[model samples]
Target: MPVNRRITLAARPVGHPQESDFALDEVDVSSPEAGEVLVRVLWTSVDPYQRGRMSEAKSYAPSLQVGDVITAQSVGHVVESNDRRFSVGDLAVGQLGWQEYATARAGTVRPVPEELDPQTLALHAVGMTGLTAYFGLFDVGKPRAGDTVVVSCAAGAVGQIAGQLAKIAGCRAVGIAGGPEKARDLIELYGYDAAIDYKNDGVAEALRGERVDVYFDNVGGEISQAVHRRLNLGARIVICGQVSQYNAERPELSFHPGLLIMFRARMEGFLVFDYAHRYDEAARKLAHWVASGKIRWREHVTDGLENAPRAFIGMLNGENRGKALVKVAERAE
Candidate 1:
């Protein structure tokens, strides 16, 4: 019997996570049965959303109990298959968890389309991360040409793409990132016309001159409070994520909604799954942008499955410049 190494929730954290909160263990993995396939996990995703999933309190998705393997979106090749749709060696993507191998139903894993450039594309630009940026920016924010689009967490995965997409739509892209270096990348690399270093300068002061028409918010907190006060008439605010307050030990203090009534703007929160029916359409457009060199993606990767916990913590700490992922194993050429 072969062993599969796994990362499981050992203890739930009161605030910021501890390394001891995770347990790495090895167990014998089951083979694929009829109508199933066994995936040799390659690349696994670590997102801020996982922090929400760790708590027992209910949200959009179910929470995980202690000792359960951490659930995650992963990409890998089929090592064994009992279903006709998935053949051995075919690359597939699914919520496979943090493990070396997993057996999933044929319907649970979707084969990555051939047109997608790289096998790892399942994790970032052409995947859900990109799609979140797509629907949040286009459908929610609804920016137009010459509109000023402001993005928070602008150096991270979705933020970087969101800023670029605004530029592609002929909008003035303004970014708010943590450091001077990330802020510089926002202007030089991500095609942002203006960039703000929230770590050094005042976010509200940085946008004093620019007319903010649409705001794509990722790390909501004081930054969001500042942006909401500067909204132009008919402005749209897309609430993506609130990473800044995700790990607080106590309940976070939220700002009053006086500005919403004052600005007469629209502020809406959305889950990417809400747009599942339109993913293919979004993917087609995003793929075109990537091939034409308009949208770009970067990955901050950890090398081993055993290190998955650290990778997750790093992402929550704002350590990644782009998408945060764990490389579980190498693909065979």
Candidate 2:
């Protein structure tokens, strides 16, 4: 039997998370029961949303209690299987948390398609992150050809994909990121027409004279307010993850109802889980785009399962360039 090490919440984070907030523990690895499979986790994702779960504040999902395993989207090899759907060597991806080994019912994990080169892509692009960008932009933002689409956190996981998707839609994509390097990557790597470095160049100054038709806002703060002032008539704002406010103990309140009224704009918030039934539909299109070189992504991976906490903290602090993942094991034994 292999050692099963997991990262658990040692304390509820007050503001930005600290390494002391997490604890490492070794648990007994359980064997697969009927209709279940034991997975050897290879890659586990560390996303911004997990920050909300670390706090006691109420939100979309139940908060994580102290001592609970940090929730993560993981891709792993099925080492032991009791279900007919999965074999001992098959690969699967799902909410397997931050652990080296996990035992889940067969239905909880979807088998990775053989064609997907480097199965770790299942943790981000063409998975939940890509789906978030797809639904939020097309369904909520409703971008049209020739529209100026603006995305916040453009160098991050969902932001990069959204920017590319906007380009694919024949819209002019503008991305806002924290630093100059990230801003450069937005245009050179992610296909954004223009990039705004919010840290150096003010959002209002950078967006001057630009009529934003679609605002895919991932960071809601002063930056969003600046974009609101530039909304074109009937502009749409898709409220995705609020990376800026995720770690705040008391989130700042700000609103622009007057701007919405004047521009006749619409602001909507959506959860990727709401579109769960149509996942395969989105996946097919995203896979096609990725295969055709229409979409590209990068990963900022941390080595070792014990570093999952540090990786999660880094992601929340905007230290990661693209998708943040923790490598648990190289491969299944």
Candidate 3:
């Protein structure tokens, strides 16, 4: 049996996750039983949403208990299979957590499309992140052509794709991110019409006297409040990940009720998993956009599974440019 290394939640984090909150453990891998497959994880995603799971808080998803393997989406290849749906050496993606090996029933994991090169993309664009942006923007945000769509945390994995999708819908894309370099990437790389560096350039000042038709809010707090004040009539606000509030023990109170009434804006929060039946619809479109160069993506990959804690911490601190991932093992050659 192979020794499987995994990261487990050691303690609930205070404000921000510390390295001590996670523990690395090694265990013997177990073979798959009937209707299951054993996978050697290649790429693991470290998203801001994972921060919410680290704490015992009421959330859309259940909080992770102490000693549980940190929740994550992973891309891997099946090494052994007891299910006809999957065969040895097939690529798969699922909520496989932070581990070198994982066992799952075939129904729980999806086969990776063979055209998706660098299989790591299954954990980033053309995968969950892309689907999140696709459903959140199109289904919830309901952006219209010629509208101005503003996205917070604009340089993040979902944020980057959301901004581009907004542009593809013929909306004027505006992005708000921290740091000058990220702001530049929002415009030059992600193709946002305008980029605001909230850390340096004031968000309110940059967006002053502007009318926002849609807001794809990724980080909620004062930044969202600033955008709220400038909403155009009948604006739509898609409540995506609230990265800024994830670390807080108590929710950061903001968002005046009057803004919604004044703007007649629709604010909706959705989970990508809720659209499971339509995942193939979104994936096919995202894959086409990516292949045709309509969408661009980047990955900030931390080298080893042992460094997952560091990568998660860095990602929470806005240190990563795009999708933050842990490269657990090399892809089978």
Candidate 4:
């Protein structure tokens, strides 16, 4: 039997995931049982949602138990198979963990498009991150022509796609990011009409210049408060994420009931998993846009599995430029 390296949850974290919260170990590998396959991990996505999983707080996904492998979305190639549906060398994407290899049930793993670029397909503009942007913007935050749409965390994976989708819908798009460079990229690279550096400027004043009919909020706290104040009557706010307050000991702001009355606005939260049935539709549309050179994706990939913890921590701190991924193994050509 071969042995594989795995990273497991050493302890439940309080706020942000720490090095002490993870334990790296080498474990014996077992052959795939019936209807299962053994995969050599190629890439693993690190997302903000994982932080919520590290805590005991209730969420869409269950908290990781101590001593269990840290769960993550992984892209890999099958090295051995017990199911007839898959064979050796088949590329698949599924929920594996932070490990060099994994044994996944046949039903959970899906084959990746053979023609798609492996690296790009793993991180951005195609996978869960892209789907989140697609459904959230079109289905939830419906921006019509001439409507002003605002997105927070504008330079991130989902934000970049949502902003571009708003533009495609003929809306004037504005973005709010943490820094000047990201602000510039949101405008120049992602086609946002305007971008505000939230770290340096007054977010409310910057957004008030435009009639914001839709606000795609990724960062909550004061930023959400600012957007709430500037929302036009009947505006729709899509509560995507609250990255800013994810690490806080306690929520910084209480929900403002007054804004709901003053603007007659609607605020709704959505999870991408709810739209799983429409993933194919969203993928087709996103792929068409990518092929036409209409939408651009950015990724921050770290080189090794050893760096996964650091990469993930940095991503939560807004250090990554786009979707963050860790390369675990190279695929055979």
Candidate 5:
């Protein structure tokens, strides 16, 4: 029998996840049933939202139960199959947990193109990060030419793409991030017109009297309030993720309702699952931009599955430069 190693949630975290929250165990790989395939995971994505899942909080998805494998989006290769739709060597992307092997239903996995770079495609510019940026900027925010678009968490996976997309749409892109180096990278590397280091400067003052037409908010809390204060008339705010407050022991600060009433600006929150039907459309456009050198994608990859918890915690602490990923296993040739 083939044995698989898996990381399971040992306890619900009160705030941030610790190493003890997870436990590793070896188990026999059960054969794929009639419509399932056994996948050997290659890479797994560690996103900010997963932090929410660690607690027994109400969310879009259910919280991780004790003893259950920690769930995540992973890209892997099919090593054995009972489903005719998938072949033994096909690479696939799906919601597989942090495991060396997973038996998944056929419908849940999407085959990845052999020509695509699995490392890059699995996380940024071509996957959920790209899709999040595309829909948040174009669909929700609807940035116009000459408009000033501000994105929080600017050096992050979704923020980098969203800022570049704003520039591509002929909008003035302003990114807000932590630290001096990330602020510089946002402008120099990702084509952002300007960047504000929230840790050092006051965000509202840094706006320099410019009215923001669109705010793509990835890190909520005080930053969201600051952006709300500078919103122009009829501006749109797209709420993507709230990484800044993810580790807070208590609920973090929020904006005043009066700001919304006074500015007449609209704020909308969306999940990427809402646009699942249009992923192909977003992927094609993002790929075209990437190929033309119009957009740049960045990733901070950790080399081992055992390091996923550490990487995830560090990401929330602003340790990662871009999308955080764990290389679980090597892709089969």
Candidate 6:
């Protein structure tokens, strides 16, 4: 019997997840049934949002129970199929969990176009990360030309795309990140017009010169509070992810609600699933930007499936530079 290696939640973590929270095991690979395909997983994503699913607390997405297979956006090639839409050797992506091989039923597995590079398209651009940035900025943020757009978590997956999208719309893209290096990448690598190192300087002080017209808040905390303080009248704040507080051991503090009234700005939180039907339209545009050299993509990959838990923890600590993912197996060429 072919064996499948996978990870599961061994225990619920109270604070930052450690290796003890995850358990790796091997099991028999199941064959696909009718309307399903057997996929040999190639790449799997490890996102900050996965941290939220670990707890029993309710979130927009369902919480994962202890001992449950850890789910992530996985890309793989079809090895056997009982579905008409997917033939052997077709590339597909879905929440195939952390297993080396996964069975994906129709509607669960989405086929990847043969022309698109599967490796580059795994979990970053053309996937949830890109879609999140696209919808968060365009739909929720509603940034305008000549607007001063500020993005937090500027070096991470969503923030990088959001900042670039802001610049593409003829806005001044400003970024605030944790480290000096990440701050530099926001400017030198991602094309942000201005970048702030929150670790070294006060984020509010750095942007005191201009009133921000749009704020893309990702790493919510003091950074978000500072940005809120600088919002211009009629500004929009897109609440994306709160990576800063995901691993907190205690209840985190919040900023004053009166700031929104004072600035006459609106703050809205969104989950990308709300606009899933319009993903194709955004993907086409993002793909064009990638092909035309407008958006520079990045992925920090950690080899081996067994290492995913630690890699995920590292990503939570802001160790990865860009989109954090794990390389589980090589895709069939």
Instruction: Give the TM-scores of the predictions, in the order they appear.
Output: 0.96, 0.97, 0.98, 0.96, 0.96, 0.97
Report the lDDT tens digits of candidate 4 across residue range 1-333.
678898888887777778887888998999999999999999998888778777777788888888888888899999999999899999888888899999999988778788776445745788888889888888898888999999988898889999999988999999999988899899889999999999999988887777679999988888888878788898998989988877777868735978878889888999998998888888888888887878887778998887888888889888998778888988888
Q: Per-residue lDDT for 4 in model 3?
A: 94
Best by lDDT: 3
Error of 1 at 94 (Å): 1.5
lDDT of 3 by residue, 8-41 (tens): 9999999888999999999999999999999999
Q: Best-fitting candidate, measured by TM-score?
A: 3
- lDDT by residue (tens digit), candidate 6, 11-74: 9998989999999998898788889899988899998889999987768889999888898999
Tens-digit per-residue lDDT, 47-129, candidate 2: 98898888878789999999999998999999999999999889999999998899999998988897997777787788889
lDDT of 2 at 92: 94
Residues 16-120, model 1: lDDT tens digits = 998998999999978888999999999999988888888766678988899999999899989999999998889999889999899999987778876787767
Poorest stretch of ten by lDDT in candidate 4: 115-124
lDDT of each model, Cα atoms only? 0.87, 0.90, 0.92, 0.86, 0.87, 0.87
Residue-pair clashes per prediction, in order, are: 0, 0, 0, 0, 0, 0
What tens-digit string does per-residue lDDT give for candidate 5 at 1-333?
578988888888777778888888899999899999999999888888888888776789888889998888888889989998999999888889888899999988888777675445756778888889999999999999999999999999899999999999999999999999999999889999999999999998998687999999998899888888888998898999988788787877677777778889898999999998898888888887887889887778998888888887788889998788889987767
- Candidate 3's displacement at residue 173, Å, is 0.2
Task: Give the Cα RMSD of candidate 4.
Answer: 1.4
Deviation from native of the Cα of residue 117 in model 6, angstroms: 3.1
TM-score-based ranking:
3, 2, 6, 5, 4, 1
